[model samples]
Target chain A: MRNLYLFFRKHYFIFLFLLLEVVSLIFFFRHNKFQNAVMYDWTSAISGRVNNTYNSIAEYLYLRRTNFILGEENAKLHARMPQAIYLADTQIYIRNDTIMQSEYRFINAKVISNTTNRRNNYMMINKGIMHGIEPHMGIIAGDKIVGQVVSVSRHFSWIMSVLHKEVKISAKFLKNNQLVSVEWHGGDYQIGVVKEIPKHLIVSAGDSIITSGNSEIFPEGILVGTIKQVKEHQDENFNTATICFLTDFNGLGYIEVVLDMFKEEKTNLKASFQEL
Target chain B: MTNLVSRNIVRFFFLILFQVLILNHINLGGYTNPYIYVYFILLLPFATPRWLLLILAFIMGLSIDLFSNTPGLNAAATVLMAFFRPFVIRAVSNIPEEELGIQPSMRILGFKWFLSYATILVLIHNFALFYLEIFRFAEFFQTLLRVILSAVFTLGLILLSELMFYGRSKK
Candidate 1:
């Protein structure tokens, strides 16, 4: 007994270090999808409260710049209004032309806290479960696609920004409607990559990329970004295109989360295929 | 004592806020996010109990990781870094009898030695972090590239912080 006591006294710090490390490892290894759901659900409340306070301060600092961006976006929309009317006038003459169509809905909320430099960047918004925000809901800022809601509390939610590697959205060429998966390469916040565009399909610089609406998270035809560069892979059949994101995630302060009514049915159907 | 506690609390909150808001947002082009919050861990008063130091490091990392939602990644990195810190300090600094009781800082260890010690320890911390995050060897080269690039950026941020916090005075 005496020897055991002395031994513990001498190596108390070592024992403590080992203990904590063991606890951390256990936590890491034991975590599964179910545990993740519970953990995020618990932390979501704490984060909502903490982020609410931090976001208010951040909101104050970005007011001028946000207003400026909003003004510019508003002007661009107004400029397009005249052309939209011209097209509508042209469409009135032709009853069955479905080529010209537009589908978009914008929900505005202040960005409380946003991190772009991290390997997994996340943005918090003031809207939450209480405000119709839910997990997997698509998010947008102004005219550009940002990310999707990962978790939500009563009054706040977290966005898995496009800057993160975990973000993969179905995107396609606006002209040909060929679907490709857009994912960030963890290099630049402003640039992401669109994969699996077959080489035979014609691709060019400055092609517009839009959401494919395959996932019910986002409505089809949401503007993602424009393809800045297209590189033909040496051996692969697919060409990779670099996308220049329209929204500056670094300066983000406001965002809108899009909630589709059919998300549950669509997600369930998609998930059922994977389970088999 | 309460005054000191309150002052530290304010500083702690401000540091974390700045870390997540401003520093975490500065991408610098690639897989590099300057972990300035480790400065909080580095600046803890010398002679702080080993257990207390580890707990503080864990909490600091947990707070950031929770916000970032990378599971236990940051907490694991910070705890490992804290565990190794005292050993690193002892290995690098041959403390004189008079300076034996002092904790490490620019004043106690001098700039060159302090920086060397800090760089080595932070590199270890970041390497462990990158490896764990990848947690796979399939894309070894890509992960290695991320580690090197992130280390350089983190080193620059650490230097900038040292300059800002301690200025030119050796003490």
Candidate 2:
């Protein structure tokens, strides 16, 4: 009607704003999960490539510090390898050949680009599909779980760093079998919050934290970090503690990507349960 | 005409690139994620059509949401901001409609008036953004804290940017 047109003309901006908001909400609700359409995927790929190019230029800036960490880690691994062989019949799991079959293999790669100062920090590594790196694989620096792989390209992959709010690393007490999760609180890059640790456990400062190995992505017994502080809730049933990570993600350069050979089979089996 | 259109085009591309590539990565602790993109909404020409301004704001914020995986929250907040900007400007500056051809800047509105305008709209944008992202009022206090902190940080950054980038155009 003429009146309807007149009303619309008078308040066109309001109607348009409302209409766009409704469309956005509809798209958001229908997808539920954030949709990574083909365009997004392509952009990520292009961005990763661009990031890798910049990483090469930045690598020379940290050669000295990176070398020191690598030397320390190599020495630690060499010392640990002998003790494991003496204790167990076979120290590690291997697919083939004479190489010691360790449950986890640490493939060294350099970080090309990284962001530690974001709500969701991500790091891009120099090695990727060509180097046998794949998505969902665990990443480590020193003895700590740095993060897990999220996306991969031919020559690069991005890590969802533990500094990110979205990252939830499985952790457990080395002294006891109790399991918990460590999540970043977006407060500090050096610290993360350990959640769901039952209050019944005798926890104290300097308590050791290790990977729970509950996720298919990471093997059991990997080092996470240690509890730096604990705030026990008098009435609440669980203890909220703060953990200090061993590896400085800001100092990231050379890292070891862990490839779990059983990953594909295990993921498929897990998917079967959801399908049923 | 061509020069004006080309200059606007170049500014738009640079603003978006600066937002996503550089400012997006800077997290100055707490819930304060610096949103320099709102500069676009704040700096839009006064003569720009209200509906078109709202649409452009929607696109700018939606593009950020798409890149950052934040769903509809940014778009919703930005459109809300665009909806309220004209009123905020009129209330603060009392510039007659005929003389509104000038763009928003310290020169046209004066430092005191422009600062008030920017602060108010930044608060509105951050309020809608942080609350919508949280999607619930259960943590009303925490959400309020985040909104206030982000607004302050964003205001500081916007003023710093104005000093650095627009310092020469002192009116």
Task: Kindly list the per-residue Cα lDDT of model 1 for residues B1-171, writing each as its tens digit.
Answer: 465446456756777788766666566554566677776777665667888888887777777776666656777888888889888777887775357433456655677877877787788778877777656675577667776777677767767766676754333
Model 2 segments beyond 4 Å from truth? A1-9, A22-36, A53-60, A77-135, A150-158, A164-166, A267-276, B25-33, B62-76, B133-146, B161-171
Cα lDDT tens digits for candidate 1, A1-276: 999999998998888777766766665544333232656677766766777777677677778987898898888888877555566356455545365433334568988777765556777788776677767778977667888877776667777888775678898889989999898866567888889989888888889999998877778887888899888899887888898877788888767778675556667988999999
The stretch of ten residues in a row with the least summed lDDT in candidate 2 chain B is B23-32
After superposition, the stretches of candidate 1 with alpha carbons farther than 4 Å from their true spots are A1-15, A22-50, A72-106, A267-276, B1-14, B25-33, B96-98, B134-171
lDDT of 1: 0.73
- Evaluate model 1: give its TM-score: 0.79
Query: What tens-digit string does per-residue lDDT give for candidate 2 at A185-223?
Result: 654677888989897888898988888888876778777
